[model samples]
Target: MNRKILVLFLLILLSQNIFSATRIKTVEFNFGGYYSATDIASGSAWTPPYIIVNLPETGIVIKNAYVEIEYLSSAGSAADVTNIDIYFNAGTSATDIVDNITGTQVPDSSGESNLFVARADVTSKITSWTNQPYSLKFVSVGSPHNMHSAKLYITYEYDDTSPIQIKTVHFPIFSDSLDGISGVISTLAQQISPVSVPFKYRCDLPESGITIRQVWFEIRGLRQSGGATTDGSINVNISGYSSEPTMTLDGALTDTYRFRYLSSTGTPAGFAPNTLQTVYVNLSGTANTNILGGEVVITYEYSNNSNVKLKTVSYFFAQSTGTAGSVTSFTVPVYLNEDGITIERIYAKISGSYDSTTVGSIEVNSAIAGNSLTSRIYQIVVTAAQISGFEFYHDLSEGRSYWYNGAPITISWTNTLAALGGCAVELFITYKYTSENKYTEFYRVFAGQTPNEVASAGVYNYTFNLFFPDPEYPVGRKVLRRTWLRGDFIEG
Candidate 1:
């Protein structure tokens, strides 16, 4: 009996050590709001203003992030290809536009026409912060298009040492067209009154053994018509879950967004698991106000139970405008703490101007590892007309993986065409490996950031701070992970 007890004690110790080692685990969260069958009119500005997606907070490390939108275009014909303009965070923050996209319409099983899907590589936008809200807007260019739905997928990694693990669920409440056009008695335009719009959605939280961390909701793209009389306000709340003035909308709320956040940190009641609750909203506001879209995001945090963790980091490189006909090569420095890192994806914003109406082209390429081109990473050939720009985000998984050795990740831009001049590029790369000593690092470029760090003859300093508190290993420890720097020229 004594011999058996000794062997069992040793086995338990060995297992604990193995599990405590740094490990990585990946997770993907999908949520969105805004589903409409009503065809948006041509030249409609960002209809259904935005769809909200809640992301994991600091303890979780994002490995890869992207957004996919599915919609219907060319409703009459199945063979017609329609060009649609998609904007991300439009008229809000981090506004990005992708225009002139020709989406091929496919036929469904019923032989119906016009189904389009578009994707955007939003790794940089999504991973920049934690527990933040993201919104997407759509614009119809050629013809009227029906927006089916919008969703966000975030793939992240976490480990045992993380203070907490987070999971989010989005319950879409009140997604319908509301036209407050005064004197227009249309079915779509409903008058604002108490109990005018009584909205409710069935919310079934996860029944698993988890604790509620935080809960929040957002009202997106609440704008008035072209001509309005007074400001607009809407009081929305979830029964038994909302506080006084759940969301206050009072201002030049034209094309604006609003949100409300509640956490256990301040509320003494402490949020309880609200399972099988029917959330209700009572919207009463001023007259002649148009509402585009809205969504509710609920985030839950609990003690991290996983022993594995993973992360993805990005480095930014900004290139200067090149000569008329030349290939400029940029050598991006390595600032990662670990050696032998592998890059997973590269996103580039290529810009140039064209004087003539003739077609022009820009060639961008990248090679990693050895100087002899051990790994051919990515190459993009963009052909544009008159004046246009390209935002190309490419994944390097097609080629064999090559280890980075603190050498410059070579990026070149060839703009030899005469029609296009002033070629420039902004590049960002996401790595595959996670740094054991860091969680996240930030870099910012500014002028006169400090008394000593001032600009000198058109040269400025990128000043930043790093703080990581490692109380103990494999436990309560915070570390610096990734960093990026981007700057714009002045007096342009």
Candidate 2:
């Protein structure tokens, strides 16, 4: 038996369940076209993004684990159809397995030319396949010239479980405090995303934790506290999909819109467990003039080896930068603990407005200036006619001593309305700090808009955006006009 063995590797990387869907595929490949004696990466349908999809449960039999090996025998002479041997765990070299299954081909006519098809039963190995990668090897013997490989059949059942889980939900309330020198965070503020922003969430998906059935982006319409209702459609945009889905607006979600990507061909390199994935949501669409803010949600379904559940998660994107002429800004916090960590950099989302007709310019400046580390003065002209937004990044690594005791930095934005209303001013600060050696803790700040930041010092929250019957502007806006200075200081 001058046996010729073929080795192939298949990738059946599963995705997090986003929708309720299942996929069963017959992975196929050719040895003569793929199995190379020396070259590792020559030809392979046995490569990644080309494997079988199964559940996480152990001892589940996959009824579709079989191979249909095809080879043509020339007319006359020593050409004959042989038997097929199936093995688990395919490799790059010729190897023999102790536990193997075999199947024979219905012999084709030796007197005439014919195509030999061999069906091998591989259910024995599949019934107890591991959560790890599993591939089948097919061996065809009995002196057949020009032996090639064919398609593999797999029966995969989609469990269709919930895509996301609400691990925890923080309340809308916020609080903060000063610990010795540094501010100890008691209850951090809730993060809010502004309108027209593709606020992205770094999705943390568990390895093989859940297979993604379907994925969708949902954005709800925004309205003020006891404000007028909006009827017009809120336009939105979404990127980074396997295949962009169609758009639709209906019901209360009429102000809302949803999109789902159908194909789950995204590789293991994409949905590996314990890795961060990108889910971007942008409101580049038209704004509902009557709305104040909107909520962003990523809805999906998944399989957990047994059952499927529909799940939705509220992500890191939440902010309502309504019309240009409205008071649309709040302050976030910057805290550095006393862990001897060096302060390095900081970022902030600066946004503001004045009236429904006229607005002002927003400027971000610091008391301490590093020729290299200090962020430049950010200024933007605001108006009812224009929406102002600027991303401010400043490096605190230069010209400042490393923050050893952790302190607080106030980021303030000052805007003067062109209208007769009290100057509607808003502000936000940047926290640029760092640590030399990895301290007790290490985390990165964000380019963000905080609805609030909770601290251990004490809970003292305030809102001055009150309304009264005013002549110049009937809809009274918040006038928080204040001075700002940037500096680096040590807390004792």
Candidate 3:
């Protein structure tokens, strides 16, 4: 997909009688954490500080990659800090273009400097990328941590062109890479081979039982040299569930059985020849009743060949720590809308200790959102009003609109309602972020805002100059043209 093709693609799609445009987007993966000798491992083409972004088995890849570094670790950099090599591994398989090349760490953006480290022009690799999990290996021949402080941005161009372009919303990513998630345990060993293809795969749960906040299922399979002949369908739902939590794909409300179509080339959802496609199920839902307290089964509906279907699967979960809080935050640094720029939304969970019947509010305030003086504020509802968790219908496109730029806002709450006091009545913020495009306080869009310290309880008012058919005249324009001729009207 080159500049010409991209433009042509957009034009061609727009020209469609039905006007179905592929959703084009960029997904940025923020990379941060402790980098030291402890993370070092030897191999040439291989390296220690390796990070993996487990992509779902079914999806589309549009373009090349980008690395934006807000902060880079100063681990191995010194007076002797040398150049380092970075490689983007295409699903751990073939060295696809843009996926196999290497680039030097952008010395200017390394260590203590938050900037672009380097971009592996794996455009070739990704252009031909079959739907599969993606991983990257960074080998520092000179200074380490030069690139670890960066974020990975990937563009996604899918065939589905729904009139609504808005997708999932998420909160900003705080430095503590593993903060919000809790009590995670790898319960089931990775299963190899679909021995009972088209049948159910089971994983037993602990007897004492654990309340699940999030369940991650990794479905993996390789392409059959020529093409994928497997159905590769799996449904996720817990029996004897304790609570009912809504589910989402990325952040949109979708069924438990996603990625039914893994193929991504010839077929709208078809896979490329010999390319691997891996699907990951990030399920967030509450059970009405306790889980069966025994077996957690994965029922497969169909598969062409036992070996061709999902050959392997991995299951894990994050346990909800029954803590109470004023508000939970899910903020992230995202873009409003720009060519090749990416965006994000928030997803949060209320402390389980709060009374489910209680009504509360979640407020999202951004630093730089569009042309408004104050950042846009969005309200999140879990179970009507009481905060429980991320619900699909409520979470999609809940972040900055395409008009907004990069501003990291705080997702906070007032414990006024949750003052139940039985649990820790604390407040959680997604994290603070300085926007790439900061406001000058006197911008054209003139973000006129009304600031108040008091609570309106969700009551607010707005006044706009709604009066014109043309952009030439400002809204609420009086008949200035007639005013100029007020003294004498020849016609009158």
Best by lDDT: 1
Which of candidates 2 and 3 is the stronger one according to lDDT?
2
Question: Which of candidates 1 and 3 is the stronger one according to TM-score?
Answer: 1
Candidate 2 residue-wise lDDT, 204-268, digit = tens: 23223444422222222221111112222223333343322222111111211111111122221
Better of 1 and 2 by lDDT: 1
Score residue 429 of candidate 1 by CA lDDT.
Answer: 39
For residues 304-411, what per-residue lDDT tens digits would candidate 3 score against the true structure?
111211111110111222335523333433322112222222222222223333333433232223322222222221222111122111111233343244354433
Q: State the local distance difference test value for candidate 2.
A: 0.26
Candidate 2 at 61: error in angstroms?
42
lDDT of 1 by residue, 364-397 (tens): 5555553423222222222111111222222222
For every candidate in turn, the CA RMSD to the true structure comes to: 21.6, 27.8, 22.7
Tell how far residue 151 is off in model 1, in angstroms.
Answer: 10
TM-scores, one per candidate: 0.36, 0.25, 0.29
Overall lDDT per candidate, in order of appearance: 0.35, 0.26, 0.24
